[model samples]
Target: MEKLKMHTPDLAEENYKKLAALFPNAVTETIDDDGNVIRAIDKDVLMQEINTKVVDDGQERYQFTWPDKRKAVILANQPIAKTLRFEKEKSVGKDGTPGGIDSQNIYIEGDNLDALKLLQETYLGKVKMIYIDPPYNTGNDFIYEDDFSQSVADYTNNSGQTDEVGNRLVQNSDNNGRFHTDWLNMIYPRIRLAKDLLSNYGMIFISINEIEVTNLVKACDEIFGNDCHVATFVWKNKYGPGAFTRGVASLHEYVVCYAKHYPNSIEAELSEEEQKKYCKRDNKFEKRVAI
Candidate 1:
């Protein structure tokens, strides 16, 4: 019998191997910061292998980008040194006993990015669905500024930015410069990591306010691919328009949904009653519903 692996797959290394296999001519050597020789893919050679004409940065193309976008991509592929341990004292058993390990539920308490990274080891391409109500950057919501290079101790002990557990939180005020840029940087890597965890049939629903809905959609389009977008459902939280801000009264938020793979899967199955109603067959098919 073979021993099971205990850690998540190194995504960067895996990607490099795949590229090297496809284009052996692109394989090259490079020196790291530690002066160690390492295998690296030559970008120029790789581009030549895939395309007849190189689309350089100067070329005009449709894209959604912000400052540090490359850094966000790097962050998603970077490996972490963190590990998760079961805390009996903090966990509740299935039978409502303390320190019992009978429960199948797991509640992780840590930085969201780190927690997501740890979950990749066991949950990659396994999760059926994911729903998240992340902080909407409305000038008051707390957003994590992920930076693994710095230690918790290195962060300033400002109560406003540093939470009790040393997670760096930034208040994305509308008045600040790079208001949208900051939020994009924060969410881009999270969605990238989340894509790995979702199975082919999995769907992710994100609850976001109007403040950042557009950017969120564009970000998801890049991560999950534009075709994978399922739908954006408007949720009316209030019966009527309550307080007026500026000149408008916000009455609802939005639930943006995306599928891991579209055309092959639907968000849900129709009810039995609804399914039976679609018995009307079209000339081209056996089962068809009215458009």
Candidate 2:
């Protein structure tokens, strides 16, 4: 008797092999998130196989892009071998002491991208809300430098440039030519992973300053869909005006909100003072209002 094949088929890997057989020229090698060399398909070369027009580097198109944006997307989809380790000594129990594996609260200290990937198994499409205050990329911020273009051999040889844990702690200074590009690459993959964790009714609130607000919004729109954007609230965080500068001295930051799926309507409760003025029969509902 023949033995059973108990494993499920890897559709993605099967499709990749099929495509490579069809277009051998498009088959290429690239480095994954973990610095492992992997086979990749050159999208431009694959597209040209079925296109009539010239699909080369000079083609005009509408896109929100920076250097290595494709690499960022690739890194988001790549799987990592790293796993989360349970630390009993660091955990707090319901009584608020250490050595509490039964604690509801868990703190993960490591690269966030790796943590996000690990959480996908448990939290994918289950989280209702997520709030993150990422680095503002104010030229002084130390952004994660992900080099997916390098192989593991090259990375290990240059491990001295990274931190003890192999984190490339590169500062995104204004002097750096690829300052914005580096920041985008760092945040792009993280957000891509975050989107997978959201439920259908899930919402994400991201706090960002004016420096990269526009770019961040564009990136989120691409990831979460343009129709899912709920609001962008301006928060005046400072009391007095900032110091003199060449441009305007802005006193506010922005909180951008996006939902996993667009809602039919949104409602909010009226304040006590406003409720008194409107009376019970103001317009629609009794106490709450829609905005």
Candidate 3:
């Protein structure tokens, strides 16, 4: 049996049209709630009861029933994996072909989403570590146009395209309406797929500044699970001089680590050499062994 399949959900266009006809004014609106304008839903009784039967449409479809409050069919498919082929040119460095550490590592320069999807076949549940430094959707920052269909060459050559042009270091300010939505959409599926790529002992590290730290934690909690949380480390990235005017001088960043499974041991004892280096004085008897 095939282990993975690509899923493409179809929208019920015909059914939606029929439903729209029943309630011509089934439009979303905002109403005054106290002093604030809040979104309000208005629907017709007849439109709510209307149901459509599946016709002989060549498109793929699946039936999903909504909650008891309302009955609706959601057309969706099971996600599958497709094989991808590519040619790689062998490189000869100064010391001949780079081997050992460098040769084993694969550098795939393309859309990470598709790259990760293709990697699902061979690298599924095999990756030991995953570190991603994604874009910060602050209005001043340049947004990544995550187009899965584009080839590496097409993406690299298209200078005028938004996907290519906007993938740079810029400020993502608050004016953009889809700031949070765009960031979530870009990272959600990638993280979901990453979870499948982790081994039982594997781990993931996410580096983010204060701007998105909270959001990143929330996302990781949902993906890696609240129980798999390992630890959060604060790293001092800068030193001296620079200081924040509004608050305490910002010189550090956060690295959130999560495990794929519950660890039998929470901590590891330092090796003999590590103990000597840290303790300065050689204390052979004080050397501890792994539990």
Candidate 4:
């Protein structure tokens, strides 16, 4: 039987030399409150004292051994069956059926998060702009109830069919234990996935009120860096409403804009036609002074 012997080598001198070369401008002497040198110590000596040792032996070989290794077991669950299937013949429009609106490019649907996810494969990194008007997190504001554990049939039936009763709207109360937690969980994953679908020069405009502006800003900062913040547009929704006698009127909403990268790269320069439209006089001084 052969026995293994380990040998270690001292690396204090080499470490001291490396530290000295790395910190060329570092001062050696310690100064006092009066700006006087309390004590002088050699940088090389100080570094050597605290330096670690490295071992290198010609016969030494590193080997990792595992005792009582366990294998990972992943259980397969039965896939849920889908109930609804679209028939192409029934989906085709009849001869007398009125055509849909021409200028209606806007699509207003329920569960924007799910809709956005479904669009991921077809529209990833293709959207030039995205604007969302989410419900403000006020005490009485309504939130879309998304099922985390819903089956495919239930989700399809609920989304495809319209009920005469009305749309399902859930009120998010501040008093709820998981009010902020639920909101965060709902928006966090969606925002993370949305980031992947934004083009290099794409922009996202989010309309928010005073209630969750801070939280929204923080979340945006996390998704898009603090440097990517373009500007916060203040849109006046109400003009002259003085219902309260105590304070100033809160009649403005905020639209936060975040760019994919540096604003200079994404920002477009004024076109020749746009500049001509604003031209009031012939001289450069007149045009500059007009605004």
lDDT against the true structure, per candidate, is 0.84, 0.81, 0.60, 0.58
Number of the candidate with higher TM-score, 1 or 3: 1
TM-score of 1: 0.83
Q: Where's the lowest-lDDT run of ten residues in candidate 4?
A: 69-78
Please provide, for model 4 over 187-290, each residue's C-alpha lDDT reduced to its tens digit, 9 standing for 90 to 100: 55456556657898888888998877877778778778888888788899887867663577788999988877745544345799987886566664543331
Clashing pairs in 2: none
Q: After superposition, how far is residue 163 of candidate 1 from its true place, in Å?
A: 3.2
Write candidate 3's Cα lDDT for 1-291 as tens digits: 955446322224434565567675664556584677653335443445555443344666753211220111121112334444443454334455533233444666555665666676678789888888787554566655544457645764663444542342223467756566556555666776777789988888888778777767777787688788887778998887465446577778889888898586655667999878877644675644432
Which runs in model 1 stand beyond 4 Å of their true positions? 1-9, 30-38, 42-52, 148-151, 158-160, 243-246, 265-291
Residue 123 lDDT in candidate 3 = 82
Candidate 3 lowest-lDDT run of ten: 69-78
Estimated TM-score for each candidate: 0.83, 0.72, 0.58, 0.54
Any runs in candidate 4 off by more than 4 Å, and if so which?
A: 1-97, 100-108, 147-168, 265-277, 280-291
Q: Native-vs-model 4 lDDT? A: 0.58
Top candidate on TM-score is: 1
> Tens digits of per-residue lDDT for model 1 on 1-291?
987555656778878888778999998999999999988778888777878666678899889999888988888888877788878898888899988888999888778888888899889999988999988999988788765566665654443487677678878889979899989989998998898899988889999999999999999999999999999999998875555656677889999999899855353567999879965657887653331
Pitting candidate 2 against candidate 4, the one with the higher TM-score is: 2
What is the full ranking by TM-score, best candidate first? 1, 2, 3, 4
Task: Order candidates by lDDT, high to low.
Answer: 1, 2, 3, 4
**Model 2, span 158-186: residue lDDT tens:** 65355556665666788889978888999
- Supply the TM-score for candidate 2: 0.72
